[model samples]
Target: MLQIFSVTFPFFALVLCGYLAARRRMLPLEAIPGLNGFVLFFALPCMLYRFGASTPIAQLLDYSVFLVWMFCGLVMVGFTIAVTLNDRIRWNDASFGALVAAFPNTGFMGVPLLVALLGPLAAAPIIVGMLVDMVITTSLCIALSRLDGADKHGMAVALKNALRGMLTNPMPWAILLGGLASYVQLELPGPVHKTVGLLADAASPVALFTIGAVLARSQILTVESKHAPIPLRDYVPVAVFKLLLHPLLVLLVGVGAVQLGVPLSRFALTVMVLAAALPSASNVSLLAERFGADNGRIARIILVSTAVAFLSFSGAVGLMT
Candidate 1:
C-alpha cells in the first residue's frame, strides 16, 4: 500500500496543489484556459504522436478492445438514460445525465496518469478509449440530446456536428499522423523530434495542474454558497455508474474478449479498466450547460467523482500491479 501511494501520490498532489492555489486565489482563474490550450493543442498531441509513432501499428489498432469498451460504455449509457426516464427526468437533461455517468476523463487525466502508472505503452489503450468516446459515446449523446429537443438543429445535424468536432480535434489528428509515420517508416528530423520530445515531456504535470485549477474554478466543494445543492438521489446514481459500474463493466467485457481469443494484452486490459475507473470528464457540466440541461447537477457529479477517485484509482492500480 505504501508502494501504491508512492506511485499515486504525486499525481493527486499536483492536483491538490492546483486546487489550493486556485481556491486561495494564488493562481488566477483566467490563466487556466491558456494552460489548457497548451496541453490540448500542443503538449498532449506531441506526447500522443510520439507514442503512436514508436509503437507497432498493430498494437495501436486493437479493434476488439475498442469494440468491447464501446459496447460496455453504451450499455451503461443506456441504463442511465432508462433509469432517469423512469424517474420522469426530462429527456434533454436525462441524456446529459447519461453522458456524465458514462464518459470518463480519459484525455487530460487518463493519458498522463496511466503513462506514469503503466508506462508509455499505456497511451495506446487510452488513445483508443478517447477515440471511442469521441466517435461513438459523445456523438450518441449529442444526438440523443437533440432528439430530446435541446437543439433545433435536429438529431442528424447534431450528430454531424459532433463528428465534425471530433475530426477537427488535434488529438485524433496527432494520433493519425503518428500512425501514418509509423506505417510509412518515416523518421522525423532529429531536431524536430527532439523538440516534440520536449513538448511531450511537458504534458503530464501541466495537464494535472490544470485539472486541479479547473476543479477549483468549478467550486464544487462550496455547496453552502449561493449555488443550490445537488439532490443526493440524482447525484449518487450517476456517481455510482461513473466511478464503479463503468469500470466493472469494462473489466468484464475485456476479460470476456480475452477469453474469446482477442489479442489484448493483460497490460492493455489493465489500461482499459483504469481509464474506465477515472472520474467523469469535467467538461460534461459545460456540455450540460450548453444543452440547457441541469448543469449544477452534472458539476456536482464531476466534483464528487473526482474527489472520491483517489481511493478508487489507487486501489485499481494496486490490484492490477
Candidate 2:
C-alpha cells in the first residue's frame, strides 16, 4: 500500500544511497569510524537533547512501563535458550548475545521509522526509550561483559564504569540538561536551537550511510564464500532470541502493564517493542574487536540477527498498528 511505502521507502532509500555511494567509492571505508563518532557523540546527542527537552517529562518518566519491559527482557534470556538450539557460551559471548537480543538499533532505525509512521507525538516515547537504552541497557551490557570475563572489580567497578560512560556520553547529558530545562520552563534560545536542529537533522541520513559503508567494508559476500565454515547452528539461537523472543517479551510486558492500569499509549507500546526488535548496534563489532572478545563470531551474530530482524519488525508493526 502507498501508506506502507510512505513509511518504509525513506529508510530503504537512505540505505540504498549509502550502499550505492560505497559501491561508487564516493566515501572511503576509513572515514566510517570517524563519521560514526560524529554521529554518535555530536549529532545523536543533539538530537536526543532536542527530543527529550521537547517531550513532557511526566510521559517520558513512566516508571511502570519501563520497569515491566525491562524485567521481561531480563527474564526472556533463559526462556530463549530453552526454546532454541543454543550453545554453552562463555560470559563475553553470552554478554554479547544478550545485548544483541535486547538492545535494538533504536538510534539509527527506530527513531526515523517512528517519526514517519507514527508522527510527532510519537517522538516522546521514542526518546524515552532511547534514554533508557543509553543509560541502562548499554551500561548493563558492558558490566555483564566485564563480569563474564572474570574481572574481580566487583559491582563498584561496574557501576563506576556505567556512570562514567553516561557522564562522558553527550547524548545522555543532552537528555539530562534538556529535561531539566524543560522542567524549569526555560525556552531554547532561537539561534542555538537552529544550529542544533541543523546538526540533528543530519543524524539519520549520515548515520545510515556510515552503516552501509561499514557493511560494505565487511565484504560479507566474500566472507560467506571463503572463510572457514561457520556453523549456521551457532547463529540460529542468537537470531531466534534477538529477532523473535525479545520483541514478544516487550509486547507481553506492554500488554500486562496496560491491563494493570499503567498509563501508556498504544503508540508508546509500539515504539518500545520496535526498539526492542531492531538489530544489534553496528558498534558491537567495533567493541568486540577492541576488547578482544570473539569479534568474528560477534560479527556473524550482528549480520544474521540484523538480516532476520526486518521480518520480525514487520510482524511487530502489524500487531501494534
In terms of TM-score, which candidate is strongest?
A: 1
lDDT of 2 by residue, 1-321 (tens): 456655666675676576567666687767667888988888877877777777778866777656766676566544533343235556655666666666667777677777777776677666666666667766776666675544566656766866886788776677778777767767878998898899889888887776666655554433644756557765567777777777778888788888989887787787777777777766666655544455566667766765565566666666677
TM-score of 1: 0.92
Lowest-sum lDDT 10-residue window in model 2: 77-86
Model 2: which residue pairs collide? Answer: none
**Model 1: ten consecutive residues of lowest lDDT:** 220-229
Query: TM-score for all predictions?
Result: 0.92, 0.85
Go through the candidates in order and give each one's C-alpha lDDT.
0.82, 0.68
> How well does candidate 2 match the true structure in TM-score terms?
0.85
lDDT of 2 at 124: 69
Model 1 C-alpha lDDT versus the unseen true structure = 0.82
Off by over 4 Å in 1: 86-88, 220-226
Best prediction by lDDT: 1
